[model samples]
Target: MEKTLYVASLFFLCFWTKAQENKPYNYFVQESKIVDSGNTIEVNKKGDTVFVAHYKRQDLINTSNQDFIKTYKGTPFFKNGWYRGKVQTGTGMEWEFVMAYNIQKEEIYLSNNPNMEATVMKPVSFTMEGHTFRQYKNQYYEVIYEGGSQIWKEYGCSLIFSNSSQRTGYEAEGGDEYDGEFLKTVKYYLKEGDRLREIPSKNRLFKLFGSKSNDVKNYAKTEGLNLSKEINLVSLFRYYDSL
Candidate 1:
C-alpha cells in the first residue's frame, strides 16, 4: 500500500509539470509602450504580428551550444509577418533578431541588439498603395504587388508659374511688379495594359472605364470618392473591378 501511494504521487507531480510546460502563453498585450525587458510581442496596423523579443532567461547549465535548439522555444511564433530567424555568426555564436516599431510613424525597425536605438535601425518593408516596398541604402524598391508592373517605369512632370503687380502708393504713382518662381514636380508611373499611366490620378478612371466615363463619374460620386484626393490606385482599381 505504501509503495502504491508513492508511485501515484510521483505520477501526479510529473503530469502537473508537463501540463504547465504545455500551457498556452498569453504574455502579449496590444499597447503602445516601450518594453524595457525585451520580452513582448507587438502587432502592426496591418493586423500582422511583427515585433518579437526573446531574452533567454533559462540557466545555461552544462549545454555545449547555448542556442542549439532544433526549434524556437518561447512565446508563440507568428507565421504571417516577417520574423527574426536563428542566425549563426562567423564566430559560431548564434543570435536572434529583435524588432521594434514606431507606431506614430508606422515604421518597423530591426536590429540584432535588443536595446538598439530606433534611429539607427533600418525600417522594415511595408505596403503602400496596395504594394509592398522596401528601402535599402536610401533607395526604394517594389517587393511585391498584384500586377507584374514595376513601380518606376516612367516619369511625368508638372510646371507652374505666377505673376502679380502691386500699387505702392496710388494708381497714378509707381507700381511694383512681382513674379513668382516657377515650380516643377516630377511624378512616377507604371504600365497598365498597353499604356504607361500615373497612379492615383483622376485620369486613371478614364483608362479603366474607356468610353464609360459618365458611369465612372457616377460611381465615384455615389461612393463619395474625391478623385483629387490622395488615393491608392490599386485599391481604387479593385473597387471599380468589383462593380
Candidate 2:
C-alpha cells in the first residue's frame, strides 16, 4: 500500500510540474530594460508568457530631440501616411494615437497632428494600417504568424548619400539635392524560445519546417501558394498550426 501511494504521489508531482510550465500569462512590455541590445522574448514550449524588452544604440528616445522632418524621395515609413494605432505603455495602459514608423531612423512617432512628429518615449507595440508590429533590436518586426512559436517580418532601409564622389563631369550635377530614395528591404524570422532564426530564402523556410516539410509542400502545391509573398507565408503557418 505504501509503494502504491508513493507511485501516485510521483505521478501527481509530475503533473503539477507540467501544469506550472504550461500556465498561461500575459506579457508586460518594458521599454527601458532590454536584452541583447534589442527587443527580446522568452518563448516556452507552449509559447505562453512572452517576456518582452527592447534596446538600441541610438540616443535615448525623447520628444524634445526635435529636428524638423525632411522630405525623402520615397516614404521612410512602413506605412506611407499617418494611421490610427494603439500603443501600450509599460504600465499596461493602452491608448489610441496617430502613429507612423520611420524605418530608416528606426523610430516610432505618434502625434495628434499628422503633419508633425515626435518620438515615442517608450518601447511599444503598435499597428500600422492593418498590420501589427513590435520592436526587435533596433528595428520593428511585424507579427506575421503566432502559435507555439512566432514568425516576424522586419522592414529595413538604408541611406544613399549623394554620389558626388562618383560623378565624372561636375560635382554640382553628381547627385541631386535629394538625400537618396528609400529602397525597401524585408526579412523573415522564426522565433522559438530564445532562438530567433532567419528564413532567408524559400528553400530554407521549407527545410526549417522539419517533420512538417512534406505537408507544407503538399499544402502549398494544392493551394497554389507562393511562399515568397508575406500573406501566403502567414497562411502556411496558420495551416501548420491547425494540423
Candidate 3:
C-alpha cells in the first residue's frame, strides 16, 4: 500500500514538472515607455500568447503586414517615428506598447517587436508620446486641451500632384503621374459637450471669447506667449475654463 502511494506521488510530480516546462510564451506590455513585468494571456503572432495587465482574456484580431508604405510620399503618420503609447482596445483592455498612427490610413501600427506585423486594435482612445487622441465621429483628433471647454486638433494628409515637371511629352508619360508631395493639414475644434465647432481662422480664435478677449491678451502678454501657436492656446484654455 505504501509503494502504491509513493508511485502516485511520483506521477503527480512528473506531470507538474512537465506542465511547468511547457509553459506558453507571454509578450510583455510596454507602459509609459517601459516594458514592465507581465500578466494575462492574449493572442499575438499566431499561437503565441501575450501577457498583459487589467484584462480578462481579450483577443487581438486582424493580423497582417503593412503593404502600403511604398506608395506614399514621406509617411501619413502623425509622428514620423514610433513611440511608446497606451491604447484602450474595444474590449476595454488598455495595452501600453510602441505604436505609430498613420493619419492617411487611419490605422494604428503595433511596433517595436521583431515579429510585429499585425494591428487588430480598434482603439477606443490612445495616448502616445505625450499626446492624447480620441475618436470624434470615427475620426481621430488630438486632444490638445481638455477642461470645462476643450480644444481638439485634427490631422490629415493629402497627396498633391507636381505641376512643374522637368520631363515633357513621352518622357513624362508615367514620370510625374504618381509623383506628388504629401501635404499635412491641422485643424482645430472647440468642444463644449457633444458639439464640436470648427475654429475657422486663427485670427478669430481669441475673438470668439468676446468678453474674455482682454483676459487672454493679458495672459499671453504676461507669459510672453505667442497666442498664434496652437499649443500655447492650451494655457489660455486653462485660464478660460477656470472662469
Candidate 4:
C-alpha cells in the first residue's frame, strides 16, 4: 500500500509540472517578424520560438558628456527619417540595431540606448502609472548628452486589447524630422495566438506603415494586395506559402 501511494504522488507531481508549462495565456500579438544583417525570419503565430526579438538583456552606455551635433557634425541622426536604436544587455554592452517591438502593461515598447562616453542632455528618468509595473511597464527612454542634444533614442508602443478575444492591434511613432515634413501615426489589426507568427521573409507592408488609409492602400497596391483584408495566423501562413 505504501509503495502504491508513493507512485501515485510522483505521477501527480509530473502531471502538474507539465500543466504549468503549457498554461494558456493570451499574447496580444500573434507573432512578429524582424530583420537584421540581411537575415529575416518570421516568428509565426505560435509563440513556440522567438526568432527576432531581444527580450531580457540590459546594458547602459553613458552619453552624458558628448554633444550630438558636434559628433555627427549636425547631420542629424537621420536623413530619410527612419527609426532605429541599439540593443543593450545588463552588462552595459551594445548590440546591433533592428526594428523591434516589446510589451509594457500588455503593450509594445521600442527603444535604443546611447553608446558609452556620450554626453547626456539632462538628468534622464522615467515614470509609469502603476507601481506593480515598475520594471514590467518600463518604456524605452531617451538618452541625452551634455550639450542638450540627443545622442540616441528609444521608443515604446502598446497594443490596446479588445473586449472580444478575436482582435488585437497596436500603434507607434518615433523618428527624426527633415525637409519640412513630420510623420507619426497609429494602426490596429486582428491576430490569434494559436497560429505560428514569425517575421515575414521580407518586412510586411503593414509593419512599415501607419494608420493612414491612403499610405496603407498605396503600400498594399505596390505589393499587389489590398489593405482592408482581415488576417489571422492560418491565413497569413497560407498567403506566405503561396508566395
TM-score of each: 0.28, 0.61, 0.58, 0.20
Off by over 4 Å in 2: 1-71, 114-117, 165-179
Better of 1 and 3 by lDDT: 3
Model 3 ranges off by over 4 Å: 1-73, 163-178, 221-224
- Candidate 2, residue 221: the lDDT equals 88
Model 4 segments beyond 4 Å from truth?
1-85, 97-99, 103-139, 144-158, 161-243
Model 4: lDDT to the true structure: 0.28
> Per-residue lDDT for 1-243 in model 2, tens only?
698667655743554455346423111221123222222223335533222222232336653321211222455556544578877644455656677676766766566554432334335577667888876665678887888668988888764543322222334553464434456789888997766789767666778778988998799889999988988988888888777
> How well is each residue in 68-145 modelled by candidate 4, as lDDT tens digits?
110001111112111343334343333333222323222222223322112111111222221011121243333221
Clashes of 3: 0
Position 238, candidate 3: lDDT:
84
lDDT of each: 0.38, 0.59, 0.60, 0.28
How many collisions between residues are there in candidate 2?
A: 2
RMSD per prediction, one decimal?
A: 22.4, 17.4, 16.3, 23.8
Ranking by lDDT: 3, 2, 1, 4
In the range 1-243, model 3's lDDT, one tens digit per residue, is: 698667655743554455346434122211122222223234444543322232222224645321111122344456655678888755455666677787766677554452443343447799898888888788899888878878889998765544433221245245433234456788888986798888755557777677987887677778987766876778877887776
Instruction: Please give, for residues 30-80, the per-residue lDDT of candidate 1 as tens digits.
Output: 222322234344454555443343322233586432211111112222222
